[model samples]
Target chain A: MEIIISILLLSGSFFIFLSALGIIRFKDLYSRMHSTTKASSFGLLLLLVGVSLFFNELNVYVKTILVVVFIYLTAPLAAHAIAKSYREKDKE
Target chain B: MAINNIVLLLSFSFLIVAFILAFVRLLLGQGIYNRIAAMDLIASIVIGFVLVYAVFIQMGLYIDVAVIISLVAFLGTVAVSIYLKNNTNKNDGDNH
Candidate 1:
C-alpha cells in the first residue's frame, strides 16, 4: 500500500514539474495558466493523500482532505480569473 | 499499514525536480508578470513540499504554514496584477 501511495504521489509530482516547465517554456499567458492549474491541482492533491497515509491521525487527515477539496474548488476559479484578465488586457 | 521507505525517496526526488523547474522559470522569465507567475508556481510547489515534510518529520505546524502561504500567494498575485495594470495605464497616458 505504501508503494502504491508513493507511486501515485510521485507520478502526480512529476506531472506538476512538467507543467511548471511548460509554464516557463510556453510563451503565451493562457498556455501557462493551463499548465499551472492542471498540474498543481493534481500534484497537491496527491501530496495531501500521501501525508494522510503517512500520519494516521483523524484530525490531520480530515484537514488535509478539506484542504484538497478547497484547492480543487478554488484553483480553477483563480486560474480562470487570471486568464480572463490577461486576455482582456491583450485585447486592449 | 506501514509506508515503505521507497515512497519517501520517490516523493523527495519528484519535489526536487519540481523545485528546479520552478526555479528556472523564476530566473529566466522575461518580464515582471512572467516572474510573478513563476513565483506563484514556486509557492504552490512549496506547499506540496511542506506537506510532505510534515509527514516525514511528524510536524503539524507545517500544514498551518502551507495554509498561510496559500492565502498570501493569492493576495500577492492579485496585488501584483493590479499594480502592473495601473503602471501600464500610467505609461499609456503619459504617451498620449
Candidate 2:
C-alpha cells in the first residue's frame, strides 16, 4: 500500500516538474500554454488519486475527486481564454 | 515508514523546484500572456503543494483549500483574458 502511494506521488511530482520545465524552455506562447495546461492537470490528478488512496476515507475521496473533476473541467477553458485573447491582441 | 518519509521529502523537493521554475518564468516572461499563463501554472503547483502537505500532516482541511485555490485561479485567468479581449476591441473601435 505504501509503495503504491509513494509511486503515484512521486510520478505526479515528476510530471509537474516536467510541465514547469516546458514552460521555461518552450519558445512560443501557444506551445508553453499547451505544455502547462495539460501536464499540470494530469499531475494534479495523479496527486489527488494518491492522496485519496493514502487516506482511505469517504470524505477525502470525495474531496479529491471533486478537485480532480473541477480541474479537468476548467483547465482547458482557462487555456482557451488565454489563447483567444492572445490571438485577438496579436491581431492588433 | 522511513522509506515513505523519504518519498514524501523527495516529492516536496520536486514541487519546490517546479514552483521556482514557474516563478522564474513569471518574472522573466516576455509579455502579459506569458506571465498570465505562468501564473496559472503556479496556481496548480500550489495545489500540488497543498495536497502533499495534507498527506504529510494527515489532515483533510488542506484539500478544501486546494479546491478554493483552483477556483480562484481559473476565475483570474478568465477575467484577465476577457479584460484583454475588451481592451483590444476598444482600441480597434477607436481606430475605426
Candidate 3:
C-alpha cells in the first residue's frame, strides 16, 4: 500500500516537473499552454488518486474524485479559451 | 516507513523545482498569455503539493483544503479566460 502511494506521488511530481520544464523550454504560447494544461492535469490526477488511496474513507474518496473530475472538465476549456484569445489577438 | 519518507522527500524536491521553473516563465514570458499559462501551471503544481502534504501527515482535512484550492483556481482560470476573450475582441477593431 505504501509502495503504491509512494509510486504515485513520485510519478505525479515527475509529471509536474516535466510540465514546468516544458513551459520554460517551449518557445510559443500554444506550445507552453499545451505542456502546462495537459501535463499538470495528469499530474493532479495522479496526486489525487494517491491521496484518496491513503484516506480511503467514503467522504474523502468522493471529494477526491470530484476534484479530479472538475479539473479534467475545466482544464481543457481554460486552455482552449487562452488559445482562442491568443489567436484572436495575434492574428490581427 | 522509511520508504514513504524518502518518497515524500523526492516529491517535495521535484515540486520545488517545478515551482521555480514555472516562476521563471511567469517572470520572463514575452507575452501575457505565457504568464497566464505559468500562473495556471503554478496553481496545479501547488495542488500537487497540497496532496503530498495531506498524505505525509495522514490528515483528511488537508484534502478538503486541496479540493477548495482546485475549485478556486478553476474559477480564476475561467474568469481570466473570459476577460481575455473580451479584451481581445475589444482590441481587434483597432489592431488591424
Top candidate when judged by DockQ against the true structure: 2
User: Mind giving the per-residue lDDT tens digits that candidate 2 earns over B29-67?
Assistant: 898999999999999999999989989998877888998
Score candidate 2 by TM-score against the native. Answer: 0.96
Model 1 residue A16 CA deviation in Å? 1.9
Return the DockQ of model 3.
0.74
What is chain B's TM-score across the candidates, in the order shown?
A: 0.89, 0.91, 0.86
Identify the leading candidate in terms of lDDT. Answer: 2
lDDT of 1 by residue, A2-27 (tens): 77667766776776777777886788
Docking tier of model 1: it is medium
Q: Mind listing the fnat for each candidate?
A: 0.43, 0.83, 0.81
Cα RMSD over interface residues, candidate 2: 1.5
What i-RMS does each candidate reach, in Å?
A: 2.1, 1.5, 1.6
Candidate 1 residue lDDT tens string, B1-96: 545666667777777887888788788776666676777788888888787777667776677777777778877777777776776678878999
lDDT of 3 by residue, A61-83 (tens): 99988998889998998898778
| Candidate 2 Cα misplacement greater than 4 A, ranges | B1-3
Q: Which pairs of residues collide in candidate 3?
A: none
> What's model 3's lDDT at A11?
94
Error of 3 at A82 (Å): 0.6
